[model samples]
Target: MPMKKKPTNICCFLPDEIVENILHRLPTKTLLKYKIVCKRWKSLISSTSFKRLHENKSLENPVLILFSRQEGKPFLTTVDLSGAVLDRWDLASIGLQNSAFLPSPFGSDNLLCLVVDMQRFFVCNPSTRRACQICLPKASMHCPSGISKASFGYVPDRNQYVIVAKFKGRRNWRMITLSRDDVVVSAGNIDERWKIIKDSARYRVADGSPWGVFADGILYWTGDADDRRCLTCFDLWEEKFFVVLLPDEIVMIQEYQDDDQWLVELNGDLHLMYKKEGQQDIELWKLDGAGDWGWSKQDMCVAGFRARFGAHFRPVMMDEKGEMLVYNGGFMEWYKLKHEVFRMGGKGYKNIHCHAEDVILDFKLHIDTLL
Candidate 1:
């Protein structure tokens, strides 16, 4: 007969770092289950240190979290790859009370941005949980149409940040480039005032491909022209637009081309994942140089996958050791050596709060805007 082994209490024997290493691999849903497995897990996993571990892992495998922008009462819902729920927060309470509006966050390092209203924006660090709100007449003056998207990009030429808000209505709306120098500044003025650079102007997005990613000192947008969808690459340094051809296989779906959906920079290359016609999977295109974008296809999804899923899987910059972290399929998933993938789960954070409109855990990561 097999020896009846006494119940081993290994958790107490292990170091906290070891425990966190194990905990970091669990899916958010599984983490929820593990939290109830025992008191040790419940206490150990809830500490700020454990959260810091997860946060560090997140900066490694940062998951792009999208929340439902409810009108008047705005809130964000997030989902992982395994279709797990994390948490959702009410934006209204945080002074982002425009429910009818869209809140898009661009993330890099510790700084996450939140685009509030049409022109206004905010940047926050999830690890420290500190946020800075943007105050400006330009942001407050412009109100975008119901269907539009906005982005925040850095201009190398000016050594400043720019907020680009794109609005789409009956016609191809306009582009409001909020430059720090554009707003009128008072000479030696102490009160908040800005010096405008370029007056806000409107132009039709070429073929309706809409805005792309801002990468390598460029703000990229997409437009479909002449029955073909192309990437409208804008040079922030020179203020010019360059068009690049998209793969013929990919249909270049319209809905996912919004400001935050497409364009992911992975391993120093831009990845464009889009839906293809009559096919279930999405296309993965890579832009390595200034020339044409290389394309490939990856099924890489179960049911309910989409171009919007790209937003949830944006690549988080690697840590000093060069590892990327992300939440895949509703679980904790991280990248190793630019290709290997791992799942990191947490306790109780899974299924924390979720619904149809709201998916995984609600963790918001925003990008920086013009100040």
Candidate 2:
């Protein structure tokens, strides 16, 4: 006969701070399951401070979020740089079928804003399987053409999430702010939450441009005003609007003819990308300094796959090895910086093509976390 030794307790050897540091590095899915380990672990995982810590850790290895619709159901897929699937969510499981996800360059605190039936809006956290429907003002709800331009962003200073939108035939923009604690609110008395922002600058967003690119607490839109192409910037903290003029070279290029141009946030700075039709090179202009209003230009040659489809691509994210993940409105491919060639088909590349039948609604770099 032998005596069985009691199971050793982990808390006796490891401190609380060390335990939290170790848990923060775990994946969101694993952490969720570990919540049942004990009461202490469950409380630590669900705390607001812990969620913020986990979010920062996740940012180091961000993934690509593909929002698409297949068979009339919305699907969200997260993939790594190697084109490996990390996670997938059938939004219909959470009663969000046929919803359109609003596109934002920098995702809003791991939360998604979805538009349902062109009238109702919902703020959802797919990781936690929680969603809250936001009530809109009467004027905003009656738009015949629905919301033309909309963006969802987070304000770090105020710890609030804001939604900015413009409806058809509306001269001013409408906005609603939700604090972190009030993200999921009662829909009974939310009508007065929306406010109209007067457009003293009279900035009109371009017809076919994407919604908005948020960087450093500001939302920017590519548009033309006063017969000139400029950037309309809305400061979330100040609740004011300003214009940033494009470089003389870019303006000259736009004046001559129409080019495929879009705004993106790269490395926490706003970048303007444009490629002329029938050209193999794409031009990128980075805003050197927001205060100084300086611009630096770089050209990326895309002759690797131009012979086949002749499609242009935009940089979505740069990996640790300095390689770029680019998207061309249809498919995503990696551009090896050292080799200067695009990697289309390989071992990991097939994972993306597996979902080719689904209609891609939006794609962006996102950091998935427990929050």
Candidate 3:
């Protein structure tokens, strides 16, 4: 007997554990392509354990995900904080048509969550380009008044992705989820159905451009608080609401308008950005519980910022070196708060013209390695 000829299998030589270790580090694009190699490969890649492993590896290096609006269209791009484009993906190719695009893409465990015209929910893997549209449950159907605030977050305890919608009509709360396959469908069963949470507080999120910042399993929004505006905190784990007090100066300014105020989460702490009515200096306040209302203040100066400070420039983030990232619709640059100068000086700060003369720049911290 000729020993039945030694088997010849390229991928079969590696153990399942080794294969999973290598595949988890590969980009989503490559992994999707590899799924067609064989049934074993497909099953392995599609397994929940493999997905959890991939997500864990991806969390290592975070990138800056940019949503640039040009000519009323939205483009999704990823770049490192150092100002280098890594991957550029067109939203149109993924069925994101002429709909009203949400500002920044929300990051979940293994996917990025986006809203279309505030009517549809799209969860996609930025790396693999695999997307699934989640249908809004009937319970979450159009509110007579309107949808005041909507946000998507992941619950680690349940290992599920949830969309929390706050309606303006009855001031009600609707919690919706995607199916096991990640498709949006009307709640079919108890597990996949929408649950309404009764509202207890009189607090409400502001109307226009209310951005949701998810940090430490809680979603934070900048909204109204009686005559003064304040930070709204929603605990995803508890499904409860809490109000965070903004700096005295911030509350005073926000009471007037929303353009000048921004809520951002940096390095796990909530940050509030605001510029007094006539000050050239922009102050960034961080929640400093050890200090005051868990708030600490840092200021930055921009030349002629007061006269030119409309919506073009917004302070979005700060790095460990104390350099702040300033986004101006079309381009992003780092400003050394301590040095009082921008990385590119004046020329480096020049706007990278987009198709739309007026664009909105939204930044979501992305993990470079994950994609």
Candidate 4:
């Protein structure tokens, strides 16, 4: 009699392509744990191509990432629009202890560029709990107190991450570029990585604008001079600075306090949200054509909320149904465009409680991925 055929494992019959498609759909945490399953699975999951695929899949199910600190311990919380918590991460677990601030307004490719204690710079993948320290120039390291402001962005065409920073008592801006492959920079090659950007326009960023709002491959900050009242634009690709004039209506308003206006990115377009004096409504001006200086305005009403308090709220995410998730200093609230009302702590909303002293460092929309 012939020997019985040996039993075969079902996983072995699956193609690498099929396995990859299945694996990419899983959460980053699951994939990270699955790395120990086999050498082949580990190699495939850790590849750059697989990371891109996982990130693309995550974009379809994005969530809000809130960075806050309670009693000096930093926390990163991921929640949906309904305020349901999905995952929470303690930044101290990844060696980010006593972090003075967190990356605000935006993240590139789901990767966060963080500055700790205004001195140590780090690039972190929050999903996989991977962090890399970026090397700064000697001047910056020697006098960390001089580091006034820093903005981070990704250049898609070149596949690089760029950081532009302004130093106190310095006219020229400094920049550091990190390639996708070189996520970690060593101290030995610091000089070769940092560059000094020539400021021909002599643009000065406003004092209150510490972080820039990045949109369309450009980093924008409020201009310092009152006469100018414009936006200082830094093109990442060209490494040049230019000025974009603000709308005449906003500039002409006599009671327009710099604090009343906030720059945010909505639907991939730059929007300027400004509140007029003695008005309960806010004006949202969308930048239509940067070259032609085209702008369209829409009024948003937030009833029962003071204009001063409402001015701090900025839209972080918008859904297909025209609902928005707006962030104040630390908390988040939902706004329904059709109903024109803010929703919080009710039947359809969840309340995020925090102590009076608890400080919210920053918040942004993030797609948790292996990257």
Compared with the true structure, what per-residue lDDT tens digits does model 1 show for residues 1-371?
89898898877688877887998665454565677877888887767666556555654444435545443365654444344444455777877764222223243332445656644555444333345555433335453343354445665455455544444332332233333332322223211443332433333354334334566666566664565666666555665455667766554455443432356655445567554444444445566555545555432432233333444454443345555444443433444433434435441123323454444323434321111
lDDT of 2 by residue, 75-101 (tens): 888777666777788888877786777
Candidate 4 lDDT, tens digit per residue, 1-371?
99998877545677999999999998777898888887888899989899889888888777666677877778877765566676778887777776644333344464677776666577766676565675446663444345677777778888777888876656678888776445533335533577789753387778888778777778888885557588887888889988788888778777557776788888777888776666666667887755675678854554534454454565777666767776666566777765767666452334442335546667777887776
206: Cα error in model 3, Å = 1.7
Q: Best-fitting candidate, measured by TM-score?
A: 4
TM-score to true structure, per model:
0.50, 0.81, 0.74, 0.83
Alpha-carbon lDDT of model 1: 0.48
> For residue 156, what is the lDDT in candidate 1?
48
What is the C-alpha local distance difference test score of each model? 0.48, 0.71, 0.63, 0.70
What's the C-alpha lDDT at position 115 in model 4? 74
Query: Which ranges in model 1 have alpha carbons more than 4 Å from their true place?
Result: 1-90, 99-110, 126-147, 155-159, 167-203, 206-212, 251-262, 291-329, 332-371
